[model samples]
Target: MATVADGHHPFAFTFGILGNLVSTMVYLAPVPTFYRIYRKKSTEGFHSVPYLVAMFSSMLWLYYATLKKNAMLLITINSFGSFAEMIYIVIFVVYAPKDARKLTVKLFGIMNVGLFTSIIVVSHFLVSRAYRVPVLGWINVAISTSVFAAPLSIVAQVIRTRSVEFMPFRLSFFLTLSAVMWFAYGLFLKDICVAIPNVLGFVLGLLQMLLYAMYRNRKQVIIEDHEKKLPAATPDHVKNLVIIATLAASEVHPVEAQPNNRNDDGDVNNNAAITEANEHEQTDDHRHVENASVEIQPNETPSAV
Candidate 1:
């Protein structure tokens, strides 16, 4: 019986270890994306909010782990998480444009510096050490729950655009798997605070995967009826008028003719007048042809014809 109990303990420990391993993998999944940003020298429209929230959650978990006994797993995983998130943020700030960099800085200050400091100060002075772990654990749970909700915007964008280009299936799949592993670990440890948020995370992850599968192959259909509804090309007469105007512009200037003898200037002016008259005649001919083309047939109604 002693041997069996020891065997069960090892199995339970293995489960927790596996869960932590998977969770760490998920947390580091964005590393490649950030690396790309670093190489390209652009954030490429990837928002800093997710990384900021992840860092904030890691900070909270680190505090919770410090307050709790036998929380080596939490400390180890969240420490790595904090490091990874900081690297991501650093790359984002370096590559991001001025406006995005400013926003990211403001978010870091508010969440990491301002809010985290406030939480630590308040929790320390107001709450007793005996109750600190539970209090901070619940706080971590709340933060994780909110982070799980962050994918909703991406989901909505996928549905709205009918494009999964912004929504990465690998991220969704790993996140879902991570949530399941963590939930199992939490359940085995009888930690409701960890288990509960992971349940929400699993559901949201599943929803994102479902959305991706549904829309992945679907093409966006854009009808150009508005463009088609625009008035047809200008009539032939109008085209002839434009052509005549262009020809008139290309003709030698009357001032150029004046530099010649007076007789030559008069002849040139008369020739230009004659050319203008011929252009007007051609325009009238085009107009007549256009009007004749518009004539209604005697035997056919206008719409039917």
Candidate 2:
């Protein structure tokens, strides 16, 4: 459905401008995330799939805009998107850890280079010019829908972890608002392909916001409660034995020491006692009490467990 004739409607132009504004915000929403990656010098768990898919989507839209008339808005915004996503990809490649970098590079080659090139070739050579716009537009619709639904994984994470940290309210709000703006734009332009995906976008965005509300105050308390461990219970018998040992230890008096000597038969002779804290000196106020333990000389023999 080439909308060359109907696309110039005044209402369409107005909504298109609004769509451009909101969509630009949507495109740039990941700026802070990339900034974090840059500062930390690691990608952490953030995947390159979303940005790569987005870049491919924008490239597809750029080609679609080229084929259609009155598509300047598409061209202008997608040009900015293309540049922004490229910068993010470059930053990711630079700071990502070794394994993450390798995976990201592989995905980049496959999605942004190889797959995109194939689409371009097929659109230009195999597909007839008349059907090009429609075919490409549908492809974009599919990709856009996937982009909107990509947060399903995040939603699951939020639910499982009982924390809203995974989903940002500002991004969700912008996504929903952007959906509304673009939906109106496409509605005014009589372009169903543009209008269709935003319906899903708006719905999914609302779902995310509602989830944020439900668990925002909880702050992962539910999961943490389950993860927390209570102190192990002490047996009554163990407690009684500890009490007896402590009393017995507290009542003990100092023992006198005898000087070492060698017997006339040439055997070593010594006197020892089970006594000592870190050192072996007993005074009027001195006390050694560590689980009722006492140091014994090696010749005195070891204690049984």
Candidate 3:
């Protein structure tokens, strides 16, 4: 357990501390998320896969930090992450419905308990002591890289939805800052395992921030408010009346044709003729309607009685 001061590169040590601070904030970013879940008393369609994977990643990193020397920063941040992810999982399980709870528990058992135990046993028993750290470091690297890439789903969502509602700028900003800090710390610490994943993290974080900026105001799917309901279908009589009125009015005030219009051999005149035909049709329909109403009247009127 070498302190940051004990290391030859004090800059690396300082960066590690900074990384720890930033990473801690990144880890705590989900507190509000979980709180919302808690207050709602339901998982509200939010999947538990993320927390499960995060816990798994933290566990893997924790194991790696324990094996590697002078990786106290890795040890600390991952430790915090492991604890935080666990609490989040617990909250999720409690609020989740029966099917979700079952699925979550199954994944935790397979990934965290069963799969994790298998990794420990295989690495411990089969791998040599000298190669153990390297093997684990590479494995951790792979997992960390994947964890960083998990945000790509959100990126795709942001792009497809053109909305930044689910992808908060603050979260992306902190993730980017954490990535920068951790990368610097790992660079100083001279641990490739710690350095590699943060490289990807930094890139993804920047991409998320870019997406947030590009789409903060613009969305792919515009959910224009349909507060005003569509007008009901026009009644047949009403439609006829409107059509008749429009036709009669147009015929009364027909537009004068220009020389170019007259060149087409009564092209403008055709419109006026059409309006006259429409008016005739409407007058015929109105007369038929009046006749039908008269036919369907009561046998005797009140004045006649």
TM-scores of the candidates are 0.67, 0.70, 0.71
Local lDDT at 103 for model 3 = 98
| Model 2: ten consecutive residues of lowest lDDT | 246-255
**Runs with alpha carbons beyond 4 Å of true place in candidate 1:** 1-12, 220-305
Expressed as tens digits, the lDDT of each residue in 142-239 for candidate 2 is: 88887777667667756766777446687788878988987887887777888999999889889989998998988757534533421222343333
Worst 10 residues of 3 by lDDT: 248-257
Candidate rank order under lDDT: 3, 2, 1
Regions more than 4 Å wrong, model 2: 1-7, 229-305
lDDT of 1 by residue, 1-305 (tens): 32232123454455557767887877777767767777888765456766787788888988877776555666678888898889888988988999989999999999999999999998999999888778888888887887777666666656665666446677678778878877876676677887899899899889989988988876434112212332233344333422222221101101011122335568899999999999999999999988977795668665744
Q: Compare candidates 2 and 3 on lDDT and give the better one.
A: 3
Question: How many residue pairs collide in each prediction?
Answer: 0, 0, 2
Worst 10 residues of 1 by lDDT: 248-257
lDDT accuracy of residue 194 in candidate 1: 74
Backbone clash pairs for candidate 1 read none
Output the lDDT of residue 115, model 3: 93
Q: Which candidate ranks first by lDDT, i.e. highest?
A: 3
TM-score, cand. 2:
0.70
